[model samples]
Target: MTKALLKYTGEVEWTPPAIYKSSCKIDVLYFPFDQQSCNMRFGSWTYNGFQVDLKHMNQKPGSNIVPVGINLSEFYLSVEWDIIRVPAIRNEEYYPCCKEPFSDIVFNLTMRRKTLFYTVNLIIPCVGITFLTVLVYYLPADSGEKVSLCSSILVSLTVFFLLLAEIIPPTSLAVPLLGKYILFTMIIVSLSICVTVGVLNIHFRGPSTHTMGPCMRKIFLHIMPKILFMRRPPYNPGDILYREDTDGDGYIDGDYSIDSCGDIKDGSKDCLNYDCSNFKSGLHDDEHRGRASVADADNVIPRQLTPEILSAFEGVRFIAQHIKDADKDNEIVEDWKYVSMVLDRFFLCVFTAACVLGTCGIIFQAPSLYDNTAPIDIQMTRITQYGISSPPTVAPRL
Candidate 1:
């Protein structure tokens, strides 16, 4: 049987299997809860004019569907998607009596991103930093670290926002839920920083910088503290506030007085009530009175300030007035410190409420995409009017 067989040829043309790589675009507007649809179109390039025809091996639409089998190792990559539909149609050349016809396949895929990664890395950190903003008020201003701590937290939040921007694509169609949260957090932190700076400025103020007016002292030291529910430190009589010497005695009274220097004695008359009845009358008595007056004046005022010549009385009066004014201003400075404390308590409550509301508003706006079976917007069609030479049109729905 082998002797009767014909001889075989040597060379044969080999055709490599066609491999297609599709270009896919991603949309991250609704990231961590976003949905995407990718298309993979298949067609033949060689033998276009009816010599080679492309066909779905199976006629049913379900039979032509290809399953996506992507398996990523990252646990944060819990994204789920599906190859939900596959549509096939014919494309014939739009020319009279032309024979170029081909089959086209368009695959539709839909996916939803899981939020595991964002919840752990983005949401938690942003939320923690937001609550931390309130701590700026809790810190004592005397430590001198309130502004520095608040500024550091502000810079940290900005760095986190920059990192978020790098991860998500730049798009304005929709803001990501986590991105909104971060933005809200950034605003709150910035406001907290401003408050911290203001509080510190108020905290460090003294009589040398600003004099607290009587109306301001009454409102801030007494009324505002009650409204803010700030606790008053236990009253210590030992730490008594300085008072004006209203009785002309060498001691101060326990009441605030606008004209505080009434204790100074002049020409044997009591300055407190401006009474001169205690002086005795006579020319010889006047001579003794003048000498006694200078000696008494040295006792009432500082000897260094009162000149021995008796003619430089104006210098002693000027020095005593300056010392009185400084004491009065020192009292006002103490009242201002109390006002700063009351303001700190007030803003602490304000920032806490703002943070809570902003966090809830930003996070809950994201839509849920689970168990959705809506029809996809993908379509595939053929050019039925071949003789008209029009552009290819979508095929009629099957």
Candidate 2:
């Protein structure tokens, strides 16, 4: 028997097999079969390949090779995989299409692309919902139709989360890009709902001129509740809402005044009757609800906003300043209240940006998607004393 030894190029940084000084080898054996398994026969066909130890796979650095009994002339491909699907680990072999080993084994590999399904879906929707948040700042608050645009976006975000959960297998795996965005969409949606509550809260407090501007009142009453910031106190008893026959007409007084909050200091000036005898029923109050009713509500107008509402809504003072022109004070108060509605939009933007940026920061830290991401190497060889040279085929990078 003639022995052919193939040497390692050392171009591959690997420890040598102890049996060989400078070479590792494969022995080729040719067998003749008159008949194969009863059902099958290679009547006119020639076959090639090798059997390698499953434990000691031979491969170059940065390569995944699955060894099979074959030669370079036959075929070239090596695939790596884990039998158990264990994460971050792989098992593989190369059917170099040959019976030779070491340098004589020639192989070629083509890379396959891996797509991140979660990232695409999650990211797009995250951006879409973020845009709607900005839209909140632009739409008119008093449409009376209720700022419904926010509700629509909020619902969309919920569907996105459900969709993501369906597509991805739950694992202790690092959070996926898409999963993060879905989470963000949900967060933004929740925030938008809160903002809507704020708008409603402000509107519920009667008109803009009476107490805090509607917008300001909304933030103080509703949205802030989520942050545990403060609760909007139910409005107070109009300081002057007492049952008295002021003009002896026998009808009790039903007036609401900011001065209701005063503790005898402002003196009964606002508490006094407005001389309603000459005054007709308030056409403005009749147009709106939540005001001095036929009598003050049993939950009577609050003497003042809940102390908590008073503290969290510093923005109310800002609205009060806008009522500059005395003649138009009422109208300006309403407008300032309108401006306050945006506080909901403002807070959501702040939170959404934080969530998106945080998700992006997570992606930047992932493994680089490039040539070295996934590696494949193939090998094929034929054993013979006579030397045979094969050309290296250009392989695609992963």
Candidate 3:
């Protein structure tokens, strides 16, 4: 009111500095990329609309001019939030207790959270941990580190979840996108631990401990190897042939000396009592005549072979049978190990794909992640003395 009467129009202006604390409802569905709108209403407490009127200070004296919501020429910038828009409107309302209308100015403060801090501190580290979870399948089972690695990663994700719990408000309405991603990653890690245990069990299995079944052998050894593009050397029983000269005979005891009839020679009674006539039943016409002649030669030969030679022959057969059984067992054990390897390769592919897709799907669910458009300009329709009227729309500022 200082010197206001001196002016021809008698208008006075006053500027005051004030601080306000506002409580805004936070929607953390998109978290760091989220936008929030908080309204600040200003009005005189005692005077009614008829006695005291409220108007946007930036409104001009033209019908087509748009009202600037707030003066930002001297506004200080914030590090964590960007002011998207500040739209103000003048409202009039009639209360039940009063005959006159109440007037107020409402300023809608729209802000977007800046994502660089969350990206650097939270997001990138989470992505790294997700990739590390995939690496658990790559480590060899014999290295004895897979379970330990999974445990460490699970603990790390738990720590991250705890940190996020502290940052986010304790509301049960909805879970934040970042929290969902962390939980998903933790679950994948936990499953990896179970998979590692299974793989280790398969890798160390022995024929004596667990016999390989037909279905398992077909899936892991026959089918999965081809699907995963794995290659292995074909098993050769002869390659693992073991020879022992138990009596300095310089011959592999595993090799049995056989006659033309496929029976052991050197006076084994089982061979001496051989039923040569049985060969005729399955032989062709010419093969039967050849076997008939061989049977006559077999009948003339060898009841004179000594008891000591027979005992040596039996001992050699026993050693040979033992060696053959050992080789078969060894092959089975190796097959189990190979099957374990195939499983590791299979899971490596699966976890890598799941981790990549799940991470991208969850992270990109926020609309603002890919949106590059400029901030929207909110136009306020003027509420005039007669009625509400549509105002001229302005293009958004870039």
Candidate 4:
């Protein structure tokens, strides 16, 4: 039973006169998180940042409390606070700003099954997207497919770069572990794409092609691995063209002739005869003929070379030998023509080296992220240190 009184003339009055009596307190509650496949818990928890957790605007008007001062005499207060979620990943360390006075309340961390989601989802996917640049090489250099692939990869790199930028805080401030690795890999991938475009330009004999200097070639050869070979298998004679080795030997059999076995061109396993002269000629040269073929015509009889034509051939061959010397002299002036090819190969080598180095650099530079320090003790000590003191007063309230 408390007596309620108002001091007008002399209604009621209580409580001894004091200089001032007020309270300033901070209350914090760390939220428990739901587990996810990703190893990291993203977002921040701070006075000012951005987050989407606990802000009950109307909860008892004070449960989510950050009371600066409570003046029971005259109520005038303002609360300045914001909440954010801090991400913590395994094998990484994170220390909260505990020495900031506040009543801490931490909900048990939601144990999530950590995964290499950064590597698996973001990194690997970016790698696959980057590898698309390599696929462009399979297309004919002169075909539109090459340009299309390059343009597409460039656009993809731009999007990925933008995404990486979004997740990163700029201003030379240290970037997050995930962002750093992602950004590094993306940079290399983007450079690889640019190099692919250059390689294609040189392959297509574009004017932008430049000679690869000897110094650069030597440097590339120095760093290149002894077994650092990444190439499509050589074109097989039997695979792309044809072979006539009846004895299963690699060389064409000497007996291979159209006149010797005509029907055996069907390539029957049981047929011991094989004519490969037709194969040496391109498929375009195999013109189909009617049943009474043009070859059977009297007017179309194959004429043997005349003595005059034979002599002309001999004379032409003899004169070509003299021209060979002239051709050699001409090549001296145009020796740099092959320099373009050398430059193209050099650019490819440099681009590949950059990619490997950049990716490894990211792997080596990733940072740790973890947090286990008890925030309660930090808050208590901070409050004690910053607590307002009474100036030699006999008694104090709060």
RMSD of candidates 1 onward, in order: 14.5, 19.5, 10.0, 18.7
**What is the model-wide C-alpha lDDT for candidate 3?**
0.71
* Most lDDT-accurate candidate: 3
User: For every model shown, what is its TM-score relative to the native structure?
Assistant: 0.52, 0.38, 0.72, 0.33
Which candidate's TM-score is highest? 3
Model 1, position 392, has a per-residue lDDT of: 30
Clashing pairs in 3: none
Worst 10 residues of 4 by lDDT: 25-34
Q: How close is candidate 1 to the true structure, as a TM-score?
A: 0.52
| Total colliding residue pairs, candidate 1 | 1
Q: Rank the candidates by lDDT, best first.
A: 3, 1, 2, 4
lDDT by residue (152-269, candidate 3, tens digit) is 9999999989999998788887889899999999989989999999999999999789998899989988898999999989976553323334564342332333442333432222
Compared with the true structure, all predictions reach lDDT values of 0.57, 0.41, 0.71, 0.38
State the lDDT of candidate 2 residue by residue for 149-218, as single tens digits.
7677777777776776675545553465555555656676666667667766664443433556577556
lDDT of 4: 0.38
Position 82, candidate 3: lDDT: 70
Worst 10 residues of 3 by lDDT: 265-274
User: How many steric clashes does model 4 contain?
Assistant: 12
Clashes found in each candidate (C-alpha, N, C closer than 3 A): 1, 28, 0, 12
Name the better of 3 and 4 by TM-score.
3
